[model samples]
Target: MRAIKFNILLILIILNFSAIAQIKVTSNTFYFGTIINIEKFAGKDYRYSLELKSTETDSLKKIVIQTRQVINKDKMLDANATKDSVKDTLWHQINVSNKINLKAKEMWLYATFEGNGNFFADNLKFEVKTEDGNWKEVPIKNADFEKHDKNPLKGFLTSAKIPDGTTISLQPRTDAVKGKALLIKSTKAAIIWKTNYGSNRRTGKYCNVNGIKIYYEIYGTGEPLLLLHGNGQSIVDFTKQIPTLAKHYQVIAVDSRAQGKSIDNKSNKLSYDIFAADMKVLLDSLHLKKVNILGWSDGGNTALIMAIKYPEYVGKLIVMGANLNPTENAVEKSMLNQLKKDFKMLQLKEDAESMQMARLLLMLSTEPNIKVEDLHKVNSKTLVLAGEKDVIKAEHTKLIASNIPQSELIIFKRETHMIPNENASLFNQTVLDFLNEADVKHP
Candidate 1:
């Protein structure tokens, strides 16, 4: 009995030691946009080589290694075999079965010892590249002898650099699919342009508009053009188009209530009408009587409201992606559902009630409602701009054009909801031409 207990204790000690000997990694973090390199080795015998255990899921794919062995005093030893011989030396090529796109969130690397007998790895080191274009060395501290497991060794790597000077091809992450793609691409292109030309202005002066403090930015000098952004986006969303628009007209971009850099009222009494009224207050604060209004997406709706509600304050209206009829398109149902999902995802409870109110207002803006007859009341020269592939159907767009007696419609070919930003050249030219025509006809 005593001998058996002693043997059991000895086995436990051996098992504990063995368990502690397996290779383990402690630190793993990487930047999103960088490259990393890993190295493998075997103990003492420089003759030993390392083999990738599996072709699948290795972090480094398409590897090109210089494998000539170093010999004494400036001499190099080549692999013993030739292409024709049984022991021919050939550069090993392994196509990683799992081709990882650089954008992937994680990756792993594995190493194995290849030699005549069992060998251990001691002084393993690696070179890593960060997204910022820098190289770093990582040293492996401990490894022990064990039968090679069929499973590959793993490491966690990330880009060590920030995404700078890298242009991400914008694609939609939502299933409104075509419309979403157009919006994302246009927004991205606009952002790139804005980054190049606009001042990095972030803050805006806050003023009370009917008991709500609204945020606004003013840039350039000339006839003022009030700029309104889409729903769920801030005034900064116009970073792309502002510089170009500023060149020709004084651009006043504002953050609508409950979005962007603007503050939302807790009273939950907000709607697009309040937003249009807030614009009036902003204009009053600036002491401007009338200005050219350029609105995109939801902002376009606000521009229409402003033109109809306060005609004296709006010189002309250039509305893009504006839907006059809310109930006519199936897209509205999808948009409403997406809005609810987005609100839940963003944890925006305060904006929820306001969003519902805004939706009701949109529904009421069309026929059989009080605002239906008001379409003919718009005396301001209106340019209805729609993208070729906008979420708003072409029939609804035509209805808007026909109803707003003094309005003209321009359908941008191959464009989507973000017409002003996506087709800036065409949009700008169209607006300039319209403004010129309005000036000639009305002046």
Candidate 2:
């Protein structure tokens, strides 16, 4: 019995030691836009200064640093995340070496401490090397990352003054080393939250045109570039394109009449002609005689109408997923059928949004009868775009492109009807390329 007791005590001691061997790492709530001072660095080119302090320096554990674009996570920053050995609690200030290639609003810097140990990092910051050989701080809030569990990320990184029609949520992650990072999700933040730099100088206003109130957002400064969204969609569809396009041009993203937050004004029917006329008046209201236009789906239909009717007003025309007609050959029957079902489903519900969706779908079903002869009337240079898996038939897109005297056709691979939203960077680049190309007058 004494021998048995000794064996049990030895086992208990071993279990206690194993439990104590586990790693215990805790950190503060992540700081957003923490701007680090640049003067501390030797050269003009500045980088992140991570001041990490460990409780007990372990030979096996190390901290790895990385920076990546939040929008395009695939592209790694030039200043790659390097793992630094933790020989002591305070050895040397980690210099994330290299000038940030992109602008301040482009990237997010992150650090991960690996292995079994407790690590502490404070005075974490990121600085940008300016064009005039000056270093600028990219302001970060809750900088030290000391507010975890007590105040989780879900309700954190927010304020009492959140923009209307938007909500921020958090997605839990287990693989996040040291519980270091959290994925902040702003479900419908496009209307208000534009960019990370808080540089959304996008101004919004309402204009009374064509017997309805049209809502529009004007971004950046340059030659006016009008952006139009798709069917059952609003200016929010161009959320991805606006930031990039605004960089080069004065982007004017508009919500079509009766769509989004715009007032319908009890119009008898919805048609592309009405939409075109309304947009024409918006231009007149803004006193814009000529402007470049980018359109997708139903908006494409309206742009073509404007180009054909008011040729003098259009500078450059870009149309994606627009159909001349919704026949079986032009638009697949299944697509039309699905639209009809959706419209009916909405209608049967007898809701405020029901009639709006139904009318829009009705417009899709019966409108946009742009004959090849009509296409010839548009004198503006055009870019005809379609997706590989678009609801609009390839032949129809080809027909539209072939009809236009000076038009470039581009069918994006692995893309569908929602090219503007799905493949925004590519679409924006293509449009920008076409817009910036040497102007060639179409006969």
Instruction: State each model's CA lDDT, in order.
Output: 0.50, 0.65
Model 1 misplacement above 4 A:
1-203, 265-267, 330-333, 340-370, 438-443
Residue 91, model 2: lDDT of 28
lDDT of 1 by residue, 272-387 (tens): 67778899989999999789998887788888888888998999888877765455451456655654455444343344544544443333333212255778988888888787
Best by lDDT: 2
Highest TM-score scorer = 2
User: Candidate 2 residues 1-443, lDDT tens each?
Assistant: 22222222222222222212122332211122222322233234547776554434333355655543321211222435555555675424575756544333244455544333445454466776766867677667655454554443332222223333322222232332343423222222221211311112236678988567888878889999998888867765676788899999999889888887676847377899989999899999999977999989999999999999988789899999998888988998888898777766766655556677678888889998878799999889899999989999999999999999988888888888876766677777888888999442221
**Local error of candidate 2 at residue 408 (angstroms):** 1.0
Model 1 worst lDDT window (10 residues):
181-190
How does model 1 fare in lDDT?
0.50
